[model samples]
Target: MVQGHYESLNRKNDERMNAIPYCDTGEVFEADTIANVWKREDKEWLKRTQSDRSGYEYPRLGESPYINMTDDFRMEKKVICQDIFWSCDGTSFVSVHNDFGIRQYLVPEESNTDKLNRNLLLPFTRFFRNQSIVSCAIDPFYTLYNENSDRLAGDRIVVGGKNFPLQLYSLMDGQCILSYDTMNKINGEYETVYSVKIDVESRVYTGSCRNKVAIYDKSRRDAVWMNQSTKKASKGRQSIISCFEEQPMGGQALSRGSLLCGSYANEMFQVDCRHQRLERLNYTRTVAGGIVQILTSDNGRYVYVVRRNSDAISIYDRRNLQHELNVLRLPFRIHHNSAKLKAYIDTAYGLSMGTPQGTILNWGRDLVEFGGVPSHNSVDDPLITSIPPESEWRTNLSSTIPATVVKNCPGDPELFALSHGGTISLCRFGG
Candidate 1:
């Protein structure tokens, strides 16, 4: 969660109330307009099928000229906003706005990319304004389970500090599912949900404030909270950050299903999600910056992290959970704003793989697949390429180097990067 999540710029005032289903691959269903439903070769429901779909539609990749970020590749913006998340099975996808509502955009797999967009798409479902807002700046966290496709449960979204109350709601019989007069108890009854991140199965949530770290387990309805001491370290992995903007920027689980988080301060933290324990992986503080994103493997094997303020990335293998095994520094001042990453897995080798010892480069919108790895054609920018796919901000860094030394100018690397200003970067890891 480096910050900026996706692409696009137009912010619409229109809101919808519905759940639309889209598939990236029809392997899931023989749907005319279905969602989350498909029977696999094993006869298992790939998901449940809901033929009647709805939402704000977006164009498919290459459907319009706006999608062509580069000549070799092009993907439609799909949705107008990019602060949140999106998931697909190849046929269609569900796009969710923080408070505006959710929309389903379809993709006729065989349909030409040049003919896709909002008009070409249809709304399968929509969530109304009472439960949602036309523009309340809702930071919805999304996840898809083994059973259901991706969805915006509204279970965990970052609402500001305690000054602003968070109202939790669930839909039932087309009514206020379970709206609660939210309270940010973390800081005093005045706590605000600064940052919220959920695990793969929608089981855990990591929420933060100015200097505290709180983890809530939905399964147990349990939580762990901690904070930092700037004047002096109070000890025991307390806060996610040791400084201000350098405070905890983001936290994510690892490829092995363990937790990893970065702070604007000099810190990166890890915890074991399966056992509901803090693994406290060994992480060394550097001048590089704070951690933005935490990506774990489906089976929880490998972990990838990016530090934006300092232009660095931490690559960790479960074996070295006590501390970072390797650190990556880049050439140009990594354009921390817009970044994305994808990791390839040789699953046949087993889920507990080790070491990212390979010549791996990933780029583009598809989060596509390459040799046993996931990759996509590059977006039209050299700066980003120089920064490294996952989260290397500056260029010209190496594992062989003693340590990153701050200089007044940018270092030279064979690669350049994109100027797109995205605070967040997406990295594919594990499953």
Candidate 2:
């Protein structure tokens, strides 16, 4: 009976593997040339075919002026933004800065390009903290309204940073709403939580120093579960975790929800929440540099990994974690610090990433509708490459891209990107 069950499992696995088509890596070109050519071609194609198609116009790629200095700052040094996130309603956004300042700005409904270009994006609310915020997350359920126009759970954000535990802050009044003790004592010191993520279930996951992951609910201050394994790696002890993301549940019948994490060693792993143990994925092996970010699809079907000092972003199938789905290579180098990526897979299927060269690179995935379904490539061509940014822009404010946070506004065909140097770029899909 056991042998029969094993055979059936193997058959199912084979069928699943055969269903996915291999992505083809066609002829490659220089980054700048690719972007220029794609823009030209896209314009030509739209001009020819858009007249026939009604209702869905492609987004216009445009930019707002550099939102750096305010009228009060003429001689002071610029404050570097560490991270930024858009609210669920897309009406406002919050930015975390290296100077321990958090600022919130409301998006104006009208496009006042001339007025905005002449001035900075002034914040409506500002909060100050003693420690620099490393990462933050908004409440998933915190939206502006309900079906009857009633206010829901809104105006709350959780932040984790240097020497402090995860604290929930109110966006309305800029007050400390709650705090979660995600830190733990290791040896003689307390570990600082570096990454924080909130899920639909109201649970927060925090990744801290010494490769630790802790789970906490808003109702309690103590961590519900903490995982700290001391397994020796090929190069001594493991490094701290850099990021955390919720992953999809696999096909296993006994599987529980999983939390994906990346470490400073460029290694990826999943924590089975129910089992409370670490599970290795196919890409668990270490790479050259640390992981910059791990972006997963909304439905959790795909994961895109960005690594430090690497020119390529790897795409993976959530179901088949053993093999990569495709590789999107960029022309510019991703520096060891201050790089970010935002990927979308639905109707607007594409990705945008920031480079150390002060440029934001974007690529439109060749899907069935956008660019007819791709044909399978030969085994010799393993890479299913993405064309260079449909839109590429370099900032004039700073030499290095300190922090690149890209947020896609819901219900709109636009993108908002922020740099640590206090510049903001607005890109519309077509226009």
Candidate 3:
């Protein structure tokens, strides 16, 4: 499987490199013209990418789809970054490190040169905590338009780690504005928060060790609801809450959305948030190795499940969770760390995820000719096929260190790759 995937990837890479003529453009990538190539270059791209209704080919993997070691953002002291999140407004991004540090990088809207220099771009604000941080999230209400229209736009974040009580910090002044002390305790010790997520209504959801999940409302002093797997750890069993995700609103009129929690067990739990007292609605079918991360498509049409240490990701029908649509196989095995997967289904059917080997792999469906017969499927149909899928590999991060997370700028063509060795690599799509 690995050899076949590599052969397909190499063939596609060669085709892409040979299709476009090498040229040098001296234009800087400003905020206004993001995710676009030069006018002449775009015409050539359209000529090469023109397909039938099925737009499965990837746009571009950058100038070259390999690691460039000369441009990495390194700090004076080595501190591994556990996770990173881009703000609602594409102006900045935040990173949580193992050294109990939270750093924010302010992306300048305007740059002087065509190429961006990682050295000049540094973290403008710094926040520190006593314990290590495992997961972090930005306030969903923090937006430039919202802040200007309403004075109370959220500028705070909820962060939790290998400690007690999830805390919310003020991004403006670097202060602990609020803390949720409603976390459940087991065996006289609080469970470590493995993952965190906040919904549109600002309700915080956290997954912890021992297959535990807690939901907190800002108005209440305690958790509104909490749950744990029926299978106990006392029987020499070890199953942790690997990840949690919230369903999208999808034009619904509800104040809160349903939540999905994944554990090391075969089944996953779903909680309906419509009732005052949330309860487990149902459990999905048995998944091998359990699910490490759950990703919802932008349109809420499908759900992507990433399994622990599995190279392939399973896709399911959003409305009918029990139905399996297709599987995405990767070129390499995902280590035990369980890298996060980012979905870009808005403009294209593509997914990006990092590997412990420091390579960022992307899977984009390809438009096949179907033996000279043109074929297409409606937008409502699930993206699946019997044949093995194709993938593109780009190792922008360190080859030695494991890659923790790969995030795309909110409205730009740039990508930020975070490595386990406290280094970040910035790669632009057209650069």
Candidate 4:
């Protein structure tokens, strides 16, 4: 019976592997180009034959019809753009800078010029009082409603920075609507909030710092709860909460009031915020070096832990969190200090990450393999020793600057990337 089950599973895996398309190397024509090429070819066919009953003539061997299609375009900014986030509707995207400025730009749906030369008009720009924005998140609820409106409404952006309060800005006019202080005493000293994420439905914002995670309720105008990591825990003694080692730099909201966070100590924690007492679940150390960012699949079936200065990403099955399903390694090293990973689950491109060398690496995978954890371990190798296969795409933006963030537009066919030297590039993949 066990042998029969193994055979069935192998067949299923084979079928799934065949279903996933291979990642593009950016050498062929994209979907848009193909469509345009077909249209042009049809017109040429009618002009040549001048009759509907004649067979169409194909292009010459050396000539390809899609040679004139534009697959990528770039835009530049004067000030360094630190981070970027796409609106839920994907019509526009917002970018933050180290100069405490937030600028929003409309995605160029149609551009005749190959290099978008003109500086795009900004809908609005919000400048905070001397506080540099490190990370930003948009309220998903408002993003959907702003898709069709003439004047964008109901959208809010949560911005976090060093020694600054978490502020929510109106997407319509770039006005500060609300602010909450996320500073907390850790071992008798206050620490700054490095990252922030907003739960639109709950109206709660979560901020993470060196050693603690703060949960701020927007309706209360103050922090409702806080969770601190302890050095050691004993049954009879009081555990001392401190931020001596762990530094949580990234987090995401999960179902049922749960939040998944990844820390610099190479630990991933799931905190249950349903009750007053914060319940911790699935606290496990990952093997992808020091984790700087964490992301979940759209379906929440798997969790991706991105490491600092490492090429591999640790993939964990949510159901069985004992071991990682697989550690995906890229061709290049990521930015050690500041880097973000963006996953494209439903698109032709699978995953994308930025590098310190201003390069964007795109990877394709069989997502079905992420469905569940394997029963048997594939290899028992050390974190630094394991190196997976190279990704399908590794395009460099500019060698002079570092890429801070890369994001795939949710409802569009473009991928956006930001550089430390104040440049944003939009890329379209070939089909």
Q: After aligning candidate 3 to the native by TM-score, how far in Å is the CA of 123 from where it should be?
A: 0.5
1-431, model 2: which lDDT tens digit per residue? 32343346445533332111011001111112323322343354455446645676533322112223234232133444566666656666776655456666666454534422432244556556655567787765454342423433466788877666678887656678787765454454456777777776677787876577788876578888888545434573246777876331111112137878887766677876687666656345645467657766544567777776677677777777677676666776665543344333322434555555554555444321222113333446434444334445443334454436555555453445445344444443331
Model 1 agreement with the true structure over 243-309: per-residue lDDT tens digits: 1111111223223344455554445555444453333444555554455445443334445555554
- Tell me how candidate 1 scores on lDDT: 0.31
Which segments of model 3 are wrong by more than 4 Å? 1-78, 109-119, 143-152, 183-191, 229-239, 246-256, 275-288, 337-349, 365-398, 413-420
lDDT score, residue 404, model 1?
A: 16
lDDT of 2: 0.54
lDDT of 3 by residue, 34-61 (tens): 1222233334445545742577663341
**C-alpha lDDT (0 to 100) for residue 217 of candidate 3:** 78
Q: What is the Å distance of residue 62 in model 4 from its true position?
A: 53
Better of 2 and 4 by lDDT: 2
TM-score of each: 0.44, 0.69, 0.69, 0.63
86-121 in candidate 4: lDDT tens per residue? 666666777665444555656655444433243232
- Candidate 3 collision pairs: none
